[model samples]
Target: MSKRYGGKFSPEEGRPPQTPSERGSFRGARRTRAGGRVNLLFFAPLPLAARAFGSGPTELALNLTALGALLLAAWLTREGILAQEAYEARKIARRPAIPRKMFASLLTGLGLGVAGLATSGVSAAPLIYAVLGTALHGFAFGLDPLKDKGMEGVDSFQSDRVARVVDQAEGYLKAMTDAIKRAGDRQAEARLERLQSTVRDMLRTVEDDPRDLTAARKYLGVYLMGARDATIKFADLHARAPNPQARDKYLALLADLEQNFTAKTRALMADSTTDLDIEIEVLRDRLEREGVHLETRDLA
Candidate 1:
């Protein structure tokens, strides 16, 4: 018999089978309460286009400017909402340097005022519309985070370093994700995601204690960069030839990496716990030296 090289047809050929957990995981991934308001703001200015066309050249220019300002305000509002969410997600996060949402509200008022002026030149109507627009915009999208979070006693310099390193590590994760997609293997992508999740756990641990940034610098910087390069090479090779053995090896590497990251995070947490215990013990000893009596319940 002549040698033949062929495999059975698969409906899911070149695609990984979806797992139960993967279903609905992405349904609300990008959906946010603020997102709806952002959408509404974007659409609210659409009427200005028609109004601009019907008006005189001066009025048309004013309406168009108002439309442009409103669109910019909408963009800024969306960005501010996203920034606030990111800030809330982190255990230690700095407030946004610029208050984008507050500025957005101001821009909204300016836009409304300009539009009103275009419709009725220099009248009380413009002032009322401006005030109402500003108030409504402020209500719909809250102000940006105004204060630094979890940085009360922490060194600003060390926190900045942690932020920089974490940002770079995230870039590595993003690069890995992008590279793996070229391989056209959803299984590989899923594996990468699992590994990335473990990596993020370590990142959160480091962020919680800026001191850990020094210890984890090698893992976050050097090791992650190496992993990213390896992933790019593996993705290229896998795209050319889908080798099961190579896939298995890559997954094994991911398993090893995840194990190390989890261990490191646990170690950092342990160190923090130890420090806290020592501080508590020292405080108790100081109280005892001061001749303070403590009941067993109070000590406990």
Candidate 2:
């Protein structure tokens, strides 16, 4: 207290004035803080998102891998559907008929591909393709006029023996079993037993008549036709019943039988030795031109 003249406070009683360097440092600190805040707003999201997933590049790669797997699954499923349609067409025509069902399957596959592009998950594409394929297969099998002519239903006696020709050409017993199981019939067991008996008889007959390949072939055809018919009937029954396990068993059996018959037929036919004599072959060729096949070239 030295007496203050006009009420001006003394330096000791008031706050001290800032120095020039101190003022500059204070302003610099404020600017630095503002810049730091802007950087945080801009860059914080990137690190935060990265951390939420896992780590930076590793997390991104995992997401990409998952997306790729989904796409591949979808594509394969679509292709599988198309293949089933082709199979159905061949079965129905009792030969390689690749028109209506094939076209439909292709269209369905394309649609499934488009769906996969729009959707997520592996199941979406595969489930869509499988469902469509199965539906089409069932429809084709149901409508197939040649279903009865399958190796499981061929007659032993006939001049041309259409059944025998088919047995030697395009026999498929396993396919019939699959058809029967899919159809879901209660009588499948009974029909299967009958078919087995027929097959045993044919095998015995063929063994007894070893030199008669023609007769053996005929009996084989009858056996095959019986098996095919059983399968068709089984399918009909399964369609009514809806048994997944039974259907799977049928499908497996069908595949096995198809392989067996295919191998047998190839072995039998690979010789290229026709029973028809050259003269008979020439006559047969002429008859084919008229859309006919001779029962016996000389007899016809």
Candidate 3:
């Protein structure tokens, strides 16, 4: 099994793993506003499921159908909420292709309406329930983002390329995470998460300046693929026979990768800063040529 990380830059270098409060790993994490009510949605369909059994032929069918629809609606609603959260988290994102929440609302209404029919057969009550349920669902979960964000002044082609590459990179990180869990070593799992965090920092940097995509492609692609493959191999071998040498070697590989990724992210940010400085200088020159004279202090 892997020992606790004791790399040169690790804060836990001679210490044990710290709790989240001690390390502040989740210091700035945003509290999610999704899925709380969605949990209730799952439970709400239980009565219909209970009623599904021990009923006559017609009532049994209606109850079963209602239960299915309501459960499906709950699932769709949860997914829609998660999608919205992802959209909000990114600096650049496309609108979801499907309006899942709207469909969920309709399903919810249909389920409720069917339930009303099962209980109170052929009446305006069912229709009323359908309308009210749909309305309430709509009001509760709200709508999906209807337009792309952070695309203003950005080339569609470039943004799309970056998005695709980032998606692939994220997939690689996820695989590393999944593989690390198989080793069943908590410290190794924690180290993998920290490494993933470093990679994501690079991702965010590239997203901020799509021009960095060219330079970061290899880091996000080739290097990450190699890391993922190594992680899988290590996990498999470690699962079969635990070895200190192998585990330490894998940890060293993680440390090296983390350092390289961090350096690359810094270089990319430096390049962006240089570009901004150049732009400012050119604008000042243009203003001066236009006979808009200003003292150094005034410019400052």
Would you estimate the TM-scores of all the predictions? Answer: 0.76, 0.24, 0.87
Candidate 2: stretches off by over 4 Å: 1-220, 273-300
Worst 10 residues of 1 by lDDT: 19-28
**RMSDs, each prediction?**
8.8, 36.0, 6.4
Residue-by-residue lDDT tens digits, candidate 1, 140-181: 778889986666678777777777787688889989999999
Best by lDDT: 3
Candidate 3 ranges with C-alpha deviation above 4 Å: 1-27, 297-300
Q: What is the C-alpha lDDT of each candidate?
A: 0.84, 0.44, 0.86
A best-first ranking of the candidates according to their lDDT comes to 3, 1, 2
Residues 220-250, model 3: lDDT tens digits? 9999999999999999999999999999999
- Candidate achieving higher TM-score, 1 or 2: 1
Query: Lowest-scoring 10 consecutive residues by lDDT in candidate 2?
Result: 25-34
**Model 1 residue pairs with clashes:** none
**TM-score preference between candidates 2 and 3, better one:** 3
Query: What is candidate 2's lDDT per residue for 1-300, written digit by digit as tens?
Result: 696554346555556675322232123222222233223323322333343266455445544443443344334333434434433423212332333334434444443443333333355774676457446534532222223222333333531243334334334544654564564454554344334433433343333333335734643666566557756765676667766776667656644554454445444444323533555678778888999856763544
* Stretches of model 1 off by over 4 angstroms after superposition: 1-31, 174-184, 230-250, 280-300
